[model samples]
Target: MTVSRVTLLLGLLLPLSAHAAEFDGAALGAVWALPFAGMLLSIALWPLIAPHVWHMHYGKITAVWALAFLLPFAGRFGLATAGAGVVHALLAEYLPFIILLTALYTVAGGIVIRGNLHGSPRTNTTLLAIGTALASVMGTTGASMLMIRPLLRANDNRRHRTHVVVFFIFLVSNVGGSLTPLGDPPLFLGFLQGVGFFWTAEHLWAKTVFMSVALLAIFYAIDRYWYAKEDLLPVDPTPDTPAFGVDGRGNIALMLAISGCVLMSGLWQPGIAWDVFGTKVALPQLARDLALLAIAGASLQFTPRALHAANQFSWAPLKEVAKLFLGIFATIIPVIAMLRAGADGPFAAVVDLVTSPTGEPLPAMYFWATGVLSAFLDNAPTYLVFFNLAGGDAQHLMTALAPVLVGISAGSVFMGAMTYIGNAPNLMVATIALNAGVKMPAFFGYLAWSCAVLLPLFAVVTWVWMR
Candidate 1:
């Protein structure tokens, strides 16, 4: 790693020495969550109501939300305490989250699938099915980035292109990532917390398959309806061309390397870790992240410029994720801490809703609670909240409390499709689609799509699997 790399890594993994204090969640009121709520609302509304302002000043807007929480937090607690909370959030939560996402985004951006099949209903569904299969192997973002351009190009000639991107976000970016920890951050956090590597695959395979098939079927039906209503443009935007094959296949090895690195981190616990402030940074985890960064860099260096050019690879998508998530991480500290505090915290009613009076776990409620929250908040942290709510014991969660785990896991991963901000890839996919000239829905419009389509399907999911 170069000096710049080291500096960047250190900035992310900032030592918690100066601010080792913890937040007093019990003392904190519900008001503390305002900044987080504001951040999410801004993300949801600004693009629809004020696209120019959002596009230009989103980072500034994010900072405003972060400060809303931070300034008050520092005043109520000491600056050290507030700063410590921030550091811990960065170290334990955001750092690994963003690093791995960045690596995946970067590596996947280098690989391009070249081909333009006519955007027939069958062809689109087949592409979605293929992307769905690839999601668990390469991640939702990876699969979406790799396949979205072609899917878009295949359908560029058609009208009513918005629904295709919407379904694409639902299947390729969210539901398809349910089967493996590598597929989504929540599952990866589960793996790091001692859930087995194949645990998610073994448990969520049925749910993943059910959702994928149902969504594909629904998409086909809807797409066929749209295909029938298709109005041709004066000039066809994308003329059907000769068959195209996979280009930059070399990045496949790099993605596998990243996956292997994650598995190794989970399995190879050598008891080596650094005490960065109050947090213990483990060697295997650190090694995995470093290896991922190197792998991403290598993929970029080795891939031909022509391939990247073809893919229209740019840092804007990653930059959007990085900026927006910083505000989320900062502002969410209080909300998550309050949730962690459970009964005494302001969200006691929320906690009450998820459990029975007899203190037994309610799998159905857990599903909706986790899923609903994940739809608005980042799913990974939302998963962590409910994981702890369900007793955070990996061994028991894997065995006796299995249903609850499945509920939390399913809700967090599956419901990330309800809106663009629900998952990292959702926003990224929407952004890419918009850049590609698909008139993607605004936040509430997208929610209308999910609410109309996904909620009924999730009811079936709850009845079949979670219930």
Candidate 2:
């Protein structure tokens, strides 16, 4: 099902003959829908093929998919500039966003610790709450990285540790990332697209409260059972270590430097010029390049050798991300192009279902659907599509639509933890966990956790806040 075919089919079926011409079959197929469709097909087929062809893990296979799809851009732009050149430019420009996210994950992962828990369940619960709160500032990835090791260390003497990590993923890795734009890239994309920076904070109170409460309750119950079991074991008196300490205070500066570079990259705006193809070409801004260079430099210079010493700072994580995202980028290019061409097609029908009597959009429904799809899609583009859709109405509707946009943005970031491919950080967390000998569940398996645990909490959030 190529994008053009889908567009042609939709064009013939739509009653709005006046708008039929908007669907450009070839362009639609090539640029809008193909990339996403390709990604789905590739993910579905990769496992069957990977063992024989590559001897790679599923993560590495995903990376390969991203790279193969993305490689064409470099080739076309460098030596054979044409239609392909334009695509290469587009993909290359977006590459830095992924790198920025990877850096965040690396820093977070480095700070985590694993030890035995000696306090009451309430004490551990308080710590988890504090850690999740920190996720908003340090990034869910950073918070997860910083805390997972400690949580694991705390439970090292116990056999009942799996549930603790599971809860951590739900609260810290996924839901906790919603409060700030810096906490999640998808929301940051919303910020770049004219959605205000503080928008989420103003609007997400209900979601934050709901997920927080539900996760805390679930953790308490689970932790109680585990605590009781631990009481049966003989207590060994080990020297009491300090609750927390800033071991590498110097590293904080490097962390800030890297973070600053990432911030500058997000704020970079390229200059636009008319091109030979009758379209605008936006040249990369100096800030964008410099920011990336600074981040790369910092990662090389500041990362402790012992920190990366165990695994040799293997390119595996980055490599895997590149591969999976390539397939995603290429596959969805055409799909998005088609969707943009026919803004009021079947998809619009879906959107219209959520509109209110006064033509006001419903924030709760929009938030849920957008968030859910973002778990599987490239949320940056997904955010753009929804933003354009919601913003396309008269300017007067902006106020009415603001909450909807916030909901979408918040939901996308929060729920991205639902699956490994939901957001970049999810995969990074998984990889780092794997490196630490904690095997994360498979794609669908992880989603089951979210569906059972997070979705109900999100429902309550939507009811209380977004409704």
The ten-residue window of minimal lDDT in model 1 covers 1-10
Q: Give per-residue CA lDDT, model 1, range 171-196, as digits (tens).
A: 99999999888898898878767798
Worst 10-residue lDDT window, candidate 2:
17-26
Give per-residue CA lDDT, model 2, range 54-162, as digits (tens).
Answer: 4255544554444443355334332222233233324343454455556665554344242345545686677688778877776675677676655655555555655
Best by TM-score: 1
How does candidate 2 score on lDDT? Answer: 0.57
- Listed per candidate, the RMSD to the true structure in angstroms reads 3.3, 8.1
**How well does candidate 2 score on lDDT at residue 446?**
77
